[model samples]
Target: MRKWLVSVLLLCALPGLSGVCHGAGFKVSEQGAKAMGMGNAFAAQADDASALYFNPAGIAFLPGIQVSLGALGILVPQTDFHGTTPLSGTPPLDTGTAVVTEHSRRDIVIAPTLYASYALENLPLSFGLGVNATYPLSKSWDDSSVFRNQVQIASIKPINFQPTVAYRVDALNLGVAAGIDITYAMVSLQKSLYSPVIDPTAPAPPFGAYEVGSLGLNGTAIYMGYNLGLLWKPRRDLSFGLAYRSKITLDITGDANFLATTPTGMGAIGLSDSALFPYTRAHASSSASTSITLPDTLDLAIAWRPTDRITLEFDATRTGWSSFEKLEFHFDSPQFAAFNNQPDPRKWRDVWSYKFGAQYVVNPRLALRAGYSFDESPVPDQTVDPLLPDADRHSFSVGTGIGTTLGSVDLAYMWVHFVDRAVHNQEMTTLRGSNGVFKSDAYLLAANLNLKF
Candidate 1:
């Protein structure tokens, strides 16, 4: 029973804590500033070291060795939740008092990347390497937020390293690359507990109401996965690229520690902490374990040069979100013998995103870029909650760059607008008996320096 309780704690404590350099579902579309400026439409025009991530085959056509460094900073607007939700019995005020809980977030988050490429002096081959952030997501709600019973804080960070190679067959440019990812995640939530021996016969508190004994759970984990890419060029002015990133399943394992305030039943009966500490309760402390799968993605793109100074590109991506339809938690304690496999329904569906971008070169040292993308949400309206208030949206971007004797520096910015979502699910797991409207916006600034010898 003790082991079972621990498993239940871990199961409820884990969900949606992973990503890849993205699009919807905690993903970042651009790995470098140039790609950021072009709305990640560089798959076929992967000319720089960033090609290690976009399309490794393009590197086979380059000369000499190149190195690049870049960073992307996301400015997230507050995610507002105008509604009430289930609580784990953690109210800091009287039940009759009104509560005001608005939103959750941080002002800024950053993702960094590094890339290097070397073209063989006499061979039709090139080699490249890249290290970058594939996914970064962080959000924290007030301890008193309506959904406090579900989740108060969550942060997931993932990084990937890729080694790429390309071979040139006359007019054909063939490329392939593989990657390994390492991720770390943490989540904290509060749940109300009861002293059954003292109050088992008493009426249960209102559904989703907070009681005195609050259980806070937090955990951490690390895991790995691999990805590969392909690029092909049939003509001088047009090219095609494809990439497949595999799913990463995280076997998250850790320990859960419980922190309780004052017990309502204990205080009501005049008993104190010293007396309750000696009891062998299932939730006092225990080990945690669960499994989570990050989705996979397939990208198809084309880069075209219709004129000497103008270049155009487009990309279509399909994500395997159906894999997350149900999340299961495996427990290790006996307290939860009756319930072993606690399954949470995500019911997420496969989604698609499309991007288009254009670039113009005015001179040897200056260039300009612009692009746009349309993204679809995987979460259904019935399941949307403050923890993941996502909706269909669009992304617009613009950028400029300059070249010098040593290297070129590119700067780009993007604006993301999420369509307001009105959630009306009477059967929701958390926000029951309530309706909510979610509004959010975000911005990204990316910069990269490409140096060549």
Candidate 2:
């Protein structure tokens, strides 16, 4: 039981780890509709209640009480892959002229956000609260696809709560703020496992290539971090903003369940050698734990108001993904020595994204916005895999805001095009497919409602 459990856990742990980390592929940058419309470049022009997310210091410049509620809808079309993966064998075998083509299951995910802030009448102080999903992912491939052993289904849901306090230095036209981020995350993953029997005389590719079982992992974790922001207005037409978010380390505990599938012609071996195939036609569950350090982020931006009715902002963001250099997991039972303390090398690198956005106030009742961004991928080619086929992206967005006596509504639409990725690396060539060309794109629609009193 201990040996079988070790095999099951090691086979699926690394990919499972990737499922939860907020890599460039998993990070959801569109937290507000107004900001989304402006290419997420509103850090310096944080004038709305969404400022709690873009730049908490902007809250100090706001008057009265403000609240904003919104949701981002993501539509991911089928991701296309064409390539070949090695078959299970002592000396890995290839598909041999039988190239494979597969598509990932389409997914539609919705992430919502809420923010509220209050400014003191006499004191240059403001307090705000925000709730949002900064990182959410849902990816799936066909259950019986060639990549099944790598990953079939992966999903992560996380909620972040932030409470912020801002102070304004009216003398210097400067504002600074600090906040705490409390995040709770849940992760689930499923993947197939190949047989351990290495028979070369089998009629098919090989005995080791046969599907023997599947593994499922479910876990939850809670962690904390902090953020700081500064905003300054040197002149009426120009403003500068800076924001920083600290890294968070999550210690996750979960249950690992394994289910075995008896293959034809192997029934005799399973019956005779129960020690080798302990869980054949049976189920086993065990406890598993792991820790991961999410990356930190820094943002700098400049906002210029060329005219009373026009606002333009340019922002650059850097993510310290290098912190995710490796992954380590621990098994609960002491007998599982084979699968303990073995670290998997990720070697991810830090990346940057550049964005520019513009908004034009057409009238007191309407505003038009447009923006564009170039986002870089942190996954090196050596570490890229089917679980998260990350690539650089070009995003385009457009939106509008409508105001009424009661409140205002903001709507935005964005299209993201991933630079098709072609990989010929040795990351997981033997066990998990990694040589392929991946193409993917997504569409996002965001809407936010704002009210002030």
Candidate 3:
């Protein structure tokens, strides 16, 4: 039977997406390039095709059919860890030795989106559609690192297809949208499974260590969710807006495989044993499944336009992170039951955030934007680990708009800095590869094209 005590612990790493969820808990806030450039404050002033995601209700005010295509590129985070905990057990090769390391991921992740909007002249109603990677993250690490058991590699990518409808009242615009998300998650990890080495000529109580191969988990799931929005224009220059996105329950199912070397790396060192996990070399595989919830959110925003050249915005967002309480995985085969078959607790609390932004129109063809945001972290220090590391954050952003002959283009860049997080948990004293101070910073670059037909 597989003893899942170990397996239960690693599932927490499965929801792992790189920096996609930065300030927020595992959710992407920037949907459209224009909204991103404006510090994601487009809820009340959603005048473009991207309104499909920012606020569908804005579609009712559009003049004709609109289409937009956009893409954002993110540089891998420079996350470094300084191990402050020490292992007090015997060591054959210092398997749990504390090592200071720099950022391991050296890849660039790209996020893309496509949107369309339509307003019927006689119906006073509008319809919109959007296609985008709602949550995008990726990372890779080396197996030889001392932190291998924590996380070697991970990737979480979720694509969303949303369709929306909106109705217009004299001063109020009401809208609702439905979405289908296809999420793909994968993880690779390496750790030592102690197989005691015995020697006849040595001490009565043998204390040498032999190592096995790495364990791997990969999964994919499709889920459903929805969003609602409302926009009210009290004056020609001022507007108020509210938006809500429902939480998603993802049922992840996939295969669990083992990756290791044969002939026992220990056998080459003269410690040939009768207890080397079967005869020569063995690699096991099994089926695994789990359930995870994506948090729900509520956003309130205000936008003010003064003198037609300057626009200012403020927003508040609350995320229901309490939905995430634990990480549990079930195995189809008894083989996994022998290694792992348990649940891990993660009592995350809800969080709130504030954002402010400004847009200045330099001319009819050019505009400039800047914004700032402060977001609280939902992951507590006691639960912080390499697999799921988090901390509060402050972000600064800048962007611009350019009008073209056939359409308009929006470009935005954001710099996110995570407040340094220090952890001192029970695992730090008990687990070999646990405990440390984590630091991270990220960059986002996006561009989009709007077409009117």
Candidate 4:
């Protein structure tokens, strides 16, 4: 039973590709305008109680209690392909030919996060806590008439929650945190290129007459990890901050079901016996388990506040993508091989992200913000598939805030431009695999709010 459970969990980490939907970076740094201006390098400075996540020790200066809430919207991202294909012995023709066309459009995702903090009043030491999320993975592709009769194979929709704590001294701060990493996974795919022996002269199967299914699963296991940071102020005008976030491994488990399908008398339930057909119903009914591991990551940052009204920040991050080189699955039932050994094309590489930002106070009650960042892609060119269209990107952002006798509030917006990425990606099949060269453009718009009492 334990081994079976392991197999189910591994299935969760199926393929590591980040298209506009899956490959995009997580931008959860919607904190105070002061933090956003400096590109969120609070790990070492811990300017506010929220700095605990950035640097627990920074919380040493935070007075009383503070709470915050914010909303972020990732605008409609866009990615498409335009290129040529070598047409050889393919359907309705002979060998030695080339074809060219465009890739399909992808969907948009909107996600949000919330946080709160409290500081110890009359103690030499201070403590604080917060909650947020990270983008694990996603995929979406729909181009069936092309080579390999490609069908969208998307394993998108994963969300994570993080809770943490910190401690502080005069000019230096340090902190650590741990929590449950819950992930909801859903995978959809199709095998629509079966050359049935049906009499071509007799009749053609209705265009929509194909087999399909939706697999929904939940992995409810507690994954644990921690983070560390330091902040120092050598002088009034000179200060520095640094932080390290540990890695986490999430083992998820849930049921896989067939949401919809067109039956063709063939299997136990009179369904067509096609290769790509996911025996999810059979696997679920028979207690077939599916699972996978979420990788770990590291973040380093720095901030410089020249004046009480002006500040600057920068950061660099690395994700444990190397931990996802390959995937393997096992079930207590025979259906395991069909689902495990099957083609799950994914070989993701580690990635690094850099951020630089600035904030200016226009007046005592209002402030403004702006910044830029460069993020690298982990997807290799050789394995670049249409489903997981990932590429390097550049982001530009701006925002503002308001202060009152009671507390303060902040908001920000960003625009991300993915560098022009053009590559040849192949979709593999049992008999053979066909390649698709893709190109795309994407954008993101985000906002955040903060409060203290």
Overall lDDT per candidate, in order of appearance: 0.66, 0.80, 0.67, 0.48
Candidate with more favorable, higher lDDT: 2 or 4? 2
lDDT of 2 at 6: 41
What are the per-residue Cα lDDT tens digits for candidate 3 across 65-170?
9999999888766677776322223344343344455456666878888989888888777788888877766666666554454567777666778888877775
What is the Cα-based lDDT of residue 432 in candidate 3? Answer: 31
Please report how far candidate 2 places residue 134 from its true position, in Å.
0.7
Estimate, for each residue in 235-331, the C-alpha lDDT of model 4 and write its tens digit.
Answer: 6655566656555554444433323222221232223434365443322222333333344556566667788888777777776565555544333
TM-scores for candidates 1 onward, in order: 0.84, 0.91, 0.86, 0.73
User: Model 1: residues >4 Å from true position, as ranges?
Assistant: 1-12, 16-23, 87-101, 176-208, 212-218, 262-283, 333-340, 426-434
For model 3, the local distance difference test gives 0.67
Off by over 4 Å in 4: 1-57, 84-108, 136-161, 171-222, 257-293, 338-345, 427-437
Across 1-453, the per-residue lDDT of candidate 1 in tens digits comes to 223333333344445332221357667777888887988788878888888777666677678999999998988657876654443224432322233447775667788989998888888777878888766666676765655544566555556677767677755456655555555544444434333122212424443332334455555666676666677777778888887777877666655455444443333222342344543233345555667676888889998999878999999988888777766655454433433577766788789999898999999899999999888998888667665688888889999888998899999999988988887663322223236578888899999999998
Question: What's model 1's TM-score?
Answer: 0.84
State the lDDT of candidate 2 residue by residue for 304-423, as single tens digits.
Answer: 999999999999999999988887777775434456776777888999999999999999899999999999999888778778888999999999999987679999999999999998
Residue 137 miss distance in model 3 (angstroms): 1.5
Best by TM-score: 2
Alpha-carbon deviation at 326 in model 4, angstroms: 1.2
Q: Look at candidate 4 and tell me the lDDT of residue 418.
A: 70
